[model samples]
Target: MLSWVPLLTVALLCWIFSAGQPYGLPIAVWAEDSSSLARQLVRMLDATPGLSVRAQLLSRAEAQQALQRMDVYGVVHIPPHFARDVQRGGAASVTLLHNAQLSTASSLVQRDVRQVVGTLSAGVEMQAMAKRGTPAQALQVRLEPIRTQLVALFNVSTNYEQFLAATLLPALLHILAMTAGAWSVGRELRDGTLGQWLGAPAGEAQAPARPSAAQVLAALLGKLALPLVSLWLCGMAGLVYLSQLRGWAVAGSLAWIALGLLLLIAVSLAAGALLAAGTLSLRQAMSGAGLLSAPAFAFSGVGFPLLAMSGSARTWAEAMPYTHYARLQIEQWQMGAPPAQSLPVIAVLLLATLVLLALATAALLRAWARPQDWGKR
Candidate 1:
């Protein structure tokens, strides 16, 4: 199941979000002004990427009806005497009446509409304030006196596919890695084979034949080694596909990303193994792994900003390995941030993996020494 699920998910998501950004979202304009300025606004709105001025309604009532019928995301009402009001420095407000239900589409419409109106308003304001000058001077006055240029970085285009899907694939893989690790360890406990797997026995052997510490460690490693390699390769494969075949650019060192992903897989596996060893019950361990990893993405600040989260919620997010990996992935994949910026996060994942491995080792050692704790369905 793990082998093919990631493959299918990657394909499905890439296909679904193939268009990097939303485009041609339908909207209507309510032109109560019936003036040249109003028509110019409509043309500009239609020209903006991801927006289409589909209708020119005569009244707010007609626009609202179109909205209700799901014919458009929202409407822009050019208020009566808009041109005269602007010419007279009235600061006329072009109202954006939009359906909030479809927030994404609505936001796009709102942005484009606001930009068009703002541009037009600036030209009117600049002309009203000063006499004609050289075209360059006029352009500078219009831009400087009335409005400021806004530049969005990293995700300048606001490509949802790049923003979400790139990190999503790794987050999903982390969940699977943890679950598989729990199943590997928990199954031994469930079948009463913890001692055998740890190179101990049904009961502790007399000191001479007993498993040495190195032997015990080797035994566990031998059991999980294949799964560890397989899962890590899957992660690398997904990344390669996205960067190479899918046309997503890798902005930073692929080495940094590869290292981070490897650590995350190890950390997840160790956490799951620890959970299984601590619980000594297959079902409980698996459930615990899911409980820990499943909801972590939400807290990782992917869909929401970390700065906006409440103190306790932010604290919780910082405690998860997935959060660090997600941050590291974005730093390297999208931001192409300096290598130094990601060093601390990578260290955290490495430290977490080590700690979890130690804890799991201790738990397994305890479980192995006490055979009676095994066979707990």
Candidate 2:
């Protein structure tokens, strides 16, 4: 039987990453004067993407209390003389109080607030210019000369749920599949059932029971077949249900997702076989496999772009099968890039799968020949 430790670890990691999806980090508003201008500003902030104004606090004390209670990630404080200053053609400022501990949420709040303030300032300046009889074309040219249009592809909103969650699901499955594969083989070795598993002849026969290479391969496949199927199904569930429900732009077809899942399963099974053949006992095999696959999530270009890494780091990341799979996912699913564009990455995944499978086969064959080393610690 497999231990529950690894399963619990995977579950906890999944929950921690997925919980950031819902509110997208809601913010709070504090309109000190309760004036028309202040209310309008609050409304604009509330409507901003990736941020929602959930609380309306009357005082700084109340806003601070909300922050302390974790009711809001940030607070926008509009001063009492904000409207009066604007009417008098004097500069008016609004203060933003944010929880620095939540860096991503705080950064989003700061960016949205800055954009709102800039838009309002531009309008105010344009009105002044109009009052002075400035031409409309001149005002337009002065405000925006280049007029660069930003077309965000794939993830338009850049929602954390869609971007992070999509990549995380497959990476987690890879880890679990690899770990389970190792456990399946390692348990048989530890419990002295490997000979029976491989269908070797009974002991005390003068000639040693030599199972053919095909028989050894079949035994390994039998151990991993269920796990590979289960992981593939989970991958499909995440791609279809979670990803589609989030409104993420999937590729033109499900073929890309299916191909990536198959590659991931192949690599995972290979990793498991290698670990089982190398380790002496079930505990060692499971631990080694866990360590091997755990860091894959970080280095797979999920949170950081591969191009931004140092040359050596980039080369190292490329060596990981997950890195290629991740690249294929972003190119196909997120960027909506054609399969041709992802051919190089797909090639890498295919090559890695083949090479790892070959290595695993050789190692397992050696272990099968020397059954005395199966449970040696």
TM values, all candidates: 0.81, 0.80
lDDT of 2: 0.75
- Tens-digit lDDT string for candidate 1 (164-187): 777887788788889988999999
Please give the CA lDDT of all the candidate structures: 0.81, 0.75
- The residue ranges of model 1 lying beyond 4 angstroms of the native Cα positions read 31-40, 54-71, 80-91, 99-104, 122-143, 146-153, 191-196, 199-213, 246-248, 335-341, 369-377
The per-candidate count of clashes, in order, stands at: 1, 0
Per-residue CA lDDT of model 2 for 226-263, tens digit only, reads: 77776776677667755566456576546876887777
Cα error of candidate 2 at position 346, Å:
3.5
